[model samples]
Target chain A: MQFLRTVLTIARKDLVIEARSRELAYTTLFFAISVVLVFSFSFVVEGVALTDAAAGILWVAIAFAGTLALGRTFERERQADTLKALLLSPVERPAIYLGKLVGLLLLMTVVEALIVPVVGLLFQAPLGRAPWLLTGLLAAGTLGFAAVGTLFAAMLIRAHSRDVLLPVVLYPITVPLVIAGVRGTASIFAAEPNLAMAQAWLSMLVFFDAVFLTLALWVFGPVMSE
Target chain B: MVSVDDVSRNYGRRRALARVTLQAARGEVLGLFGPNGAGKSTLISVLSTLLRPSSGRVRYGTHTADGAGDALRGHIGVLGHDLFLYGDLSARENLAFFGRLYGLDDLDARVTDALRLARLSDRADDRAGSFSRGLRQRLALERALLHQPRLVLLDEPFTGLDDDSALVLIERLRSLRERGTIVVMATHDFDTAEAVVDRAICVDRGRAWPVAAGAGTLRERYRRTLKERG
Candidate 1:
């Protein structure tokens, strides 16, 4: 209960702050759209091939855009020097990590929603049999992404080269989750509807979420406290 | 209520604090006055369980500092220069956020009481980002007190406040002391120190010197002591 309370409070606060800024959310949305548009131009758009590639395109968009959004997750905290205050609080450190993770999850969800229609429009993809299932897989992969992303964001902010360092550190570490996420996404698009493949990817994502989030929680207090 | 013996912290070969020992009882305000880079904040960071001591030991209440820092955190609150507040959050939102962080059961009531105590009930809905320096400081005080912590560690709590705001804060700190909250505030401001704290300790080069010989003669003597130590 104590852990949940702290995490919820942090997530709520971040949401409120993001709502007030509007630009932070808008920035990620714009970035997501831009990535899709650029992909549309770069890849062949006139053929049925583009339609078949819709799931891959959407996952790629989310992954790239999420990387951008996650980097800015700690921007306001660092700018206002408010991290010190939060660290000094009696609340558990893992609570802060979970809170930030949830907050990022909320932001990424909004980005995902905006990209879904764009992906359909750009590629003219057919409506898949299990849209909700695809969304569930996306959320699971994102949970794992955000868990690790939050911890790295805190570390990246302190480095002398934040912009270059974040993606460099994040993408390589998150390869398996991304692959699982992309595969899980692809299965829904495939006419065969292989539950086994989707389940395998989803399970992999859940395992990654559990491990990375636990590690992030364990180290986040010591990291943020510094 | 708080005790530290031979406590030290270092990063690589750079020592932040070294072989420091101190103790404070309930209802006592232990002032940690030091110039910049004297390890005052570092020591407070260790005590607050934010930083681990490289060696030695610290104890707060029943928890030893080395292993059970989180256990100690429940009994401690801190007010540093960093308000750690969300700029877009209103006073009430800010207080409620922190209140929830502490897992307070009656969150709304606690937030209301904290707002009133900080004299911010009227502006409870104002965004903290737009607040003046003084108002923000007031809100920061409210944030520190939301958890009803037994010990409060304040780092430069009076830095940017005006005379009136500073006085109000001093009164609030005095009241907390009266309520038996052990406060250890760090500052270089002698006037505010004299105006508020019951006792002062001058910290220099990772060491602490209590001003016990003549508490009234602190302002002059504390200054001289720092100069000599430096």
Candidate 2:
């Protein structure tokens, strides 16, 4: 119950703020649209190239937009020095991580929803068999990215070149998720649509999400407090 | 009661607070007097369970401050120079938000009471980002009081307040003390310390001087010691 309250409060505050500003949603959607538009114009969408390249382009959009959202998750709090207040509360650190994860998931899902239709219309690519499989993978991938990004973003905010440093630090560690996400998308988009192959990527996503989230929670309190 | 024994902290080669010891009973408001870099913030951070000491220990009731000091933190409230209130949230929303974190019952009622004490009930719906320095300080105080904590560690709580706000805060501190809450405030201001805190300790070069009974107030003693030490 304590953990749930912590998650809810943090997530609620973040979502409320995002709702008011609409920056997270707006930026994420714009970025996703630009990614699809740029790819659509750059590649010939009339032939097999459109179908063959859809999964890679889709994962790239998710990864890139996910990074943008997670990067700003704690910027306002850190800037206004409110993170100290949050830390001072009795809620454990892991709860803070989970709360941020949920907020990021919500925003990332919104961006994904926008991108799915855009991808479908622009690329003439179908979501294919196991559509929910695609959503599940996207959710897991977003969770992994958000967990690692939130932790690193907190650290980056303390450094000299935070904006430049955030992506440099984040993108490298999150490569596994990007790879798994693409492979997961590819499995669903493939002709055979093999369950075992899709499950493997999904399993990696889940495992990565669990591992990074636990570690991020363990390290977040000390880093943010400092 | 809270006790600190030989607590010290270091960052690489720079030692912040070195082997400082302090003790305060319930209801006693202790003022820590120090200039910049006197390790006042570091000491407060360690006691408030925000930072771990490189050496020594702190005790709150039966709990040790090293590993499980978090249990002690639950019973304490901290208001640092950093307002620590979310700027986007309204004054009441900020209070309500923190009140829930501390699991306060009737969170809205608690927020209402806090805003009243902070004299911000009229501006409860105003974003904290729009507040003046004095108003922000007042709101931060309200945030600290939302949980009705038994212990409070304040770092420079009087920095940005006007005379009226200062007086209001002193009155609030006195009431908290009357209710048996231990308040530890670190400040560079003697007049404010003289008005609010009962016992005062001078922190210099990372060591806390032994508090002694003297004529005048704790602030007077603190100024005299700084001069004498110099």
Candidate 3:
């Protein structure tokens, strides 16, 4: 109960601050929309959209926007120099990691909510076909991304070139999750809609989430200790 | 009681602290007087367990940092050069956030009391970013003490404060000492620090030199230590 309370408190604090500043929200959403617009040129092919480009564009938007959110999340802590205070708090390190992951996931979810429909509209993909499956894929993929992202951002909070360093470190590590996400969504968005293949990819994503979350939780404590 | 036994910390090739030892008792305010890069902040970090000493150890009573774990951290309150208060959050919100992290049960009452201690009850609803340096410093100090830590570590608590703000801080330190809280402060400011420091140690060039009474004023003693020990 105590551990969970600590996690929720951290999430609530981040939410309250973000609510006031709107720093991450505005920056992430704008960047994501811009990404979709820029990529639309390549995938749209003059006037007609590519048949299977929506999945790739959607994940690309998410990954780019997620990276932005992850960077800013810890930047807030570093800006106020409050990261040490959070560390100095009596709560467990995993609770801190989990709280940050939860906040990032929430922010990414909002960005995705905006971008998914935008990608569907622009790319002419069938977003309404598998609403439940699409939500699951997004949730699992986001969890996998944020689980590792939160840990890395926290570790790099004090680095001199953290802004450049974050995505460089984060992207290579999260490629496997992104591949699974892209493949799963691609199957669902396909003309025939391969439900079985999509399910398999979703299962793979869940497995990836468990592994990344466990590794991040295990690694967060020791990494932050130094 | 806090005891640091011959602790040395290094950042790769550069040695930040070298074979230094110190002690502070309950109800005492120990001052670490030093110039910039003299390793006073490094010593404070080692004592706070924010940095691990390459050699030696620090203890709070019978428990070592590793042995006591989070419990040791729980009893420690640190006010670093940075206030660590979120600017977007209101003063009350900042206190409430940290208070929750410390798991204080009577949160509302504690937040109210801390705001009062900070003399920020009037501006409690204002954003911390809008606060003056003194106001933020006062709020930060109260935030650190919100949990009533057994040992308080402060790195330049009087850095940017007016006379009135400095007096409030001095009074608060005296009150903490009276309540038997062990307070350790690192500062270059001698005039203000001299008012509360029960014991003084002059740190220079990553080494700890015990302050021996030299002439008058902490400035004189500090200068004497540097000139004699250098």
TM-score of every candidate: 0.91, 0.93, 0.98
What fraction of native interface contacts is shared by candidate 3? 0.80
Query: Pick by DockQ: which candidate is best?
Result: 3
Q: How close is candidate 2 to the true structure, as a TM-score?
A: 0.93
Q: Tens digits of per-residue lDDT for model 3 on B1-230?
A: 79898888899999988889888998999999887999998888887777888999998999998888787899999999999999999999999999988889899999999999889999999999999988999999999999999999999999788998898899999999999999999988899999999989988889998777857998888888889999
Expressed as tens digits, the lDDT of each residue in B1-230 for candidate 2 is 99999999998999998899989899999989888898998999988888888999888877775556455567888998888977778998888888878887887777888889999889999998899988999989878877888889998999889998899899999999999999999988887778777788888889888555668666667778887875
lDDT score of residue B129 within candidate 2: 86
| Per-residue lDDT of candidate 2, residues A5-119 (tens digit) | 8899888999988988898899988998899888878665444445456778888888788778866776777776677777778888778777877888888888988898887
- Could you give the candidate ranking by DockQ, starting with the highest? 3, 2, 1
Candidates ranked, most accurate by lDDT first: 3, 2, 1
**Number of the top candidate by TM-score?**
3
Chain B TM-score, all predictions listed: 0.93, 0.94, 0.98
For all the predictions, what are the DockQ values? 0.60, 0.64, 0.84
Candidate 2 at residue A157, lDDT? 65
Candidate 1, B25-108: lDDT as tens digits = 888888888778888998888878777789988888767855565556767888877776777889998888767666678889
- Candidate 1 chain A worst ten-residue window by lDDT: A43-52
Name every residue pair that clashes in candidate 2.
none
Instruction: Tell how far residue A130 is off in model 3, in angstroms.
Output: 1.6
Off by over 4 Å in 2: A45-51, A155-157, A190-196, A217-226, B66-69, B210-221
> In angstroms, what RMSD does candidate 2 have relative to the true structure?
2.3
